[model samples]
Target: MKKTAYQKELAIKATQKREGTDNNKRDVMKIQSWLTLFSMRNPDSGTATGIDGDFGPATERAVKNFQSFNSLTKTGIVDQELFDKLSSNLKEAFEKPLVGNNLRSLMIEVAENHLKQHPFELEIQGQSNSGPWVRSYMDGHDGSPWFWCMGFAQTILDQASSAIDKNFKALMPLTYSCDTVGNTGLEKGLLSRYQKIRRDPSLLKQGDIFLIQKSRLDWTHTGVIIAVEGDVIETVEGNTNHQGSRNGVAVMKRTRSLRRSKIDVFSIEPLV
Candidate 1:
C-alpha cells in the first residue's frame, strides 16, 4: 500500500515559507511534494519530476504548464495559487472532521470577543489601528497604523484554531489580501465554485468567508458571513464604519443583497 498524504503528516499544515522569488529549501520542498501528488491528477498537469527539493527548470515548466491548462496565468512561478491548486485533492484526502465546535462557530466567537471591545476607526492613530486584539495578524507592525480587515479575519482564525481542532490555517490562507485568498481557493478547492459546489447561499454555513469581487483580478473587501437569509447575507467586517469602502473606518456588522455584491464564497469541508 502507498503511504497516503495523511501518512506523510505534512499535508495538513499550510506552507508558511513562500519565497516568491527566492531559491529556498522550503519552497522547493512544498512545490516538489505538491507536484508529485497533483501531477497524478492529469497526465498533462505535470509528471513527478522527482522530489529532489529543487525548484529547477523542470518544476518551473511543470508549474507553468499546469497553470496554463488550469486557466491561470502562466507566470511559471510556484506562488500561493500554484501550491493550493496542486493540493486540492491531497488537502481533501487528509481533512478530518472537526472534533467538537466547527471552525465557523469558533471563529465567530473570536470575532464577537473583539466586538466586545468596540474597536473603532483611528485613521492615523497607530494605537487604535493596531489594537492588541487584532495585533497577532499585524505581521511585525504590532502597534502601528494599518488597514486591518484582513488582520481581523486572520486573527479570528489564529485564536479559533488554537481553541478547536480544525486546520483553519490550512483551509484559509493566512494572508491580508482577500483576492489572494480567493485565488488560492480556486485550486485548493476552497471556493464554493458552481462546478464542484452548489452556488446556493442556502448551502453557505456560518463562519464562511466571502469576497467582494471587484474585478477578474481583484477582490476589494472581505467579511465573515454571520447569517444568510434568502439572498441577504449578514457579515461582521473590520476597518469600516458605514457605506462600505475597501478601506473602511471601523469594525461593523452589516447585511446586504448577495446578488448585488457579486460575492465569491470560499469554504472548507468536514466542519462539525
Candidate 2:
C-alpha cells in the first residue's frame, strides 16, 4: 500500500531530529533499522537494508529514497522530520504484539541468581594526590585490583548459562582484555563490541552481556542487559560512581536516539 501523507510527514520530522550528533555514523545505522521496521509495516514505504549499526551505501540509498518519496529534500540524510515520521509509523506497528518469547527474561533471572550465590566485596577507587588508587581493605597496603568490567559481564553470562543447565560452549563466547577497549573486534574504536550489539538488536536476548561505551570516543565501559522494552533498553553496569554512590551496579535506561552510546550484547540460547 502507498504511504499516506501523514506518514510521510512523520518520517520527515524524525529524520530531521536525528541530525548533529558526535556519533553520526551510529545514528545513521539506527535510523536505517527504524526505517526497516517501518517498511515491514507499510511494505511500499521504501526498502531499508536493516540496521547493521553501520553507515554504508545501502543505508544512504534508503535514506534518499525515503526522503524523495516523502517530498522532502533528497539529501540522503535523516533529519528530525524523517525520524518523527518513522517513529510514528513504528509506534503503530508496536501496538500489535509480534511474539513474546521469555528466553531473554529467563536468562536475566538466572544471572541474578548466580550473582547472589557468588557475591563478593565491591571496592571503590579514590583519587589520591599522586594518582588514582583504591581504599585498602586494611589500609597502609596496596588496594586490591577492582573488579574489571569485562569479567563482571562475563561472569553473569556464564552463570546464566549454567543455571539453565546449558553447556557454556554452545553459548556465545566472551573474551576481555585491556587491548580490546575501544575495539569491537570489527574496527578500532573504544567500546566497539557494544556498538556491534546495538546495531543488531535482533541478536540480543534479555540477559545478554553488553559493554557500554563510556563516551562517544571512549569505549571503556561494560554492562549487562537487564530488560528490553520495545525501543527502550535497560542496562545494569558497574563502576559508575554517580549520585554520591560508591562502587556498585547502576541501571541506565536508553532509547534508540542515543546511537553513539553503544553497547556490545552477546545473545545465548538453550539447547533443546
Candidate 3:
C-alpha cells in the first residue's frame, strides 16, 4: 500500500544524505524530525536526535543505534529501508483497512487508530508544529501557523469517507482553519449552534464534530465526538492536551461539559 504524501516526501528525501549542506538543510530537518518522532513513539528505538537540520555525528549515531536495535545492518545512514522502519508506525495507523457498517463508526474507528499511534507535534529548528504527524495531517504543511485541529478532524472524516466511497469535502472544506469549517457548517445547515445544542444534547452524536466557538463568527478549535453521555461529551481531538488548549502538542481524549464552553456541533447526519 502507498504511504501518505508526507511519507512519500520523506522517502524521497531519505535517498540523499541531506548532511546539512545549505541546499539540503530542510531535507535533513525532515529526516531528523521523523527520527525524533519515531523515537518518541517507540522509546526502545534509541533513535532520539535533535532536529537541527544538520546531519552531524550525533544524528549518524542515532541512525546506527536505531538500525542496530532493529536488527538491521548498522550503516549509520538513513536509507530507504531504515526510513521505512522509522515510519512504519504511522503507515500502519493510517493505511490499515477499517471495517464499519456506517460512516460514524468508521470515522470513530479511524480517529481511534490514529490515537493508538500517539500522534504528537514537534518543534523543529525552533518552529512549532513541525513534525511528521503534523505534516501528515496538514497536507505536508507544518509550522506555527498550521494549527491542525481541523486538519486532523477532516483527515479522519476523509479516511472514513474513503472507506464508504463517499466524498468528505462535499460535507466540509478541506482546511486547517476552524473558522472555515464552522462557516461551511453554517452554510450547509449542518451546524447546531451552542444554544441549540445546550437545549438538546442528543443533537450531537458520536462522529459529529464539535467546534469551540470564540465569537458569533469565529471558531478556535475542533474535534471528533467519540461519545456523548449526558452533559459531558468525550472527544478525540488533535492539537490539544489535558488542559484542552487549542494550541496543544498532541492528539488527546478530553471531556468537555456542555454548559462550560461555547461549542457548536457539525452534524454528519446529512452524510448518513
Candidate 4:
C-alpha cells in the first residue's frame, strides 16, 4: 500500500522507534494494515491483526508471529528489518503467478480455512443473519436470509485469487447463482461434464465447482470440489448442513457420490 503524505511523515518517525516507543497513531495503523494483509494471505499466520492503526497487544502478537514465520527475531517490534520483510512478502504475493493447480490449491486452502469457522450463519438485523463473513460472499449486497451457497463459493474464489493478485472474476464469473458458474465455465471452455448418462467421478479434481440443478431454469446448489475418489467426491459446501440441503444451515465438508444426472462440474481454466 502506498503511504499517504501524512503516513510518510509518520513513517519516518515510527521507523526509528521500537516496541516500547510511543509511535504516531497513523504509523501504527499503517503497520496494522500490513499485519492484517500478511495474515489474510498466509494460512498459518495466526489471528490477523486488525487494521485499526492502533498499536495494541494483538498487533504485537501478530508482529511476533510474522517475524517468527520470516525467521526474524521475535521482538514484537515494527522495526526497519521487519517492515522490509513484510513489504517484500507482500510484493511477492502480489506478483505471484496463478498457473496450473495454483488457483485450485488456493481455493481449496480458503475452503478449508472457512470450514473451521463453522456454525457461521445469518442474522436479521444485528443478530446472526448478517455479519462480515456473510456479507463477504454477498458482494456488498445486504446479506439477508437468502440462499447463499453460490455466494459462498464465489466469495471464496474471489478472496483466494486476490490473495495472490489473480483476477478471480476474470477466471470465473462472480455471481450468486450456480448457473452462472456453469454457463461461464462452458462458454469459456473450462467446464467438463461427460456426455454419458453416468459420467466418471474421477474426471473431477480439487477446486472444481459442482452445480446441482434445482429446476429447469437454474442450477440451485453449489460447492467446491476438494478431491475425487474412485466413485465418490469430497466437497466443502456452504449454506449446507449434515443432510446437505440447498437451504442448509452452515458450511461443511461432505463426501458423496456423483449424481451425473443431476450434477454439472465447472473446472477452472488450465485445470481440466
Better structure of 1 and 4 per TM-score: 4
Q: Write the per-residue lDDT of candidate 1 for residues 1-272, one digit (tens) a residue.
A: 11121233232233322234456664475566565445544666664565555667777777777778788887767655556666554333223233437667766665666554354432123244532223334553433446677766665565566666455566656677887788887778667743222356666768777777777657777777778787787888887668987666556788867666777777745443
CA deviation > 4 Å runs, candidate 4: 1-101, 125-129, 143-145, 194-197, 215-217
- Candidate 3 minimal-lDDT segment of 10 residues: 1-10
Q: Looking at model 1, how many pairs of residues clash?
A: 3
Best by lDDT: 3
What is the C-alpha local distance difference test score of candidate 1?
0.59
Residues 1-272, model 2: lDDT tens digits: 01112232223323322223433544554466466644644578675565545556677777777777677787766666567664553233212222323445544554454333222222223321100111111111222344344544544444444444555445433444322533433342212254455565555556655545555544555556777664456664433334312244322222322254555544443432
Error of 3 at 48 (Å): 2.1
My TM-score estimates for the predictions, one after another, are 0.55, 0.38, 0.91, 0.57
lDDT of each: 0.59, 0.44, 0.82, 0.63
User: What local lDDT does model 4 show for residue 228?
Assistant: 77
RMSD of every candidate to native, in Å, equals: 19.1, 20.5, 2.7, 8.8
Show how many residue pairs clash in every candidate, following the order shown. 3, 36, 0, 6
* lDDT, candidate 3, 1-272, per-residue tens: 11145555446353535353342666666668777777876798878898887788888888787778778888776666767777776787788889897999988998999998888899876789768888888888888988989888988888888887788877877778889889998998999999998899989899999999999999999999999998899999999989999999999989999999998999988777
Taking all chains together, the TM-score of candidate 3 against the true structure is: 0.91
Better of 1 and 3 by lDDT: 3
Residue range 12-125, candidate 4, lDDT tens digits: 254523445667765675566556545656869863655554577888888888888878788888776667565453223223343434777887877777675452444433
Residue 143 displacement in candidate 4 (angstroms): 4.7
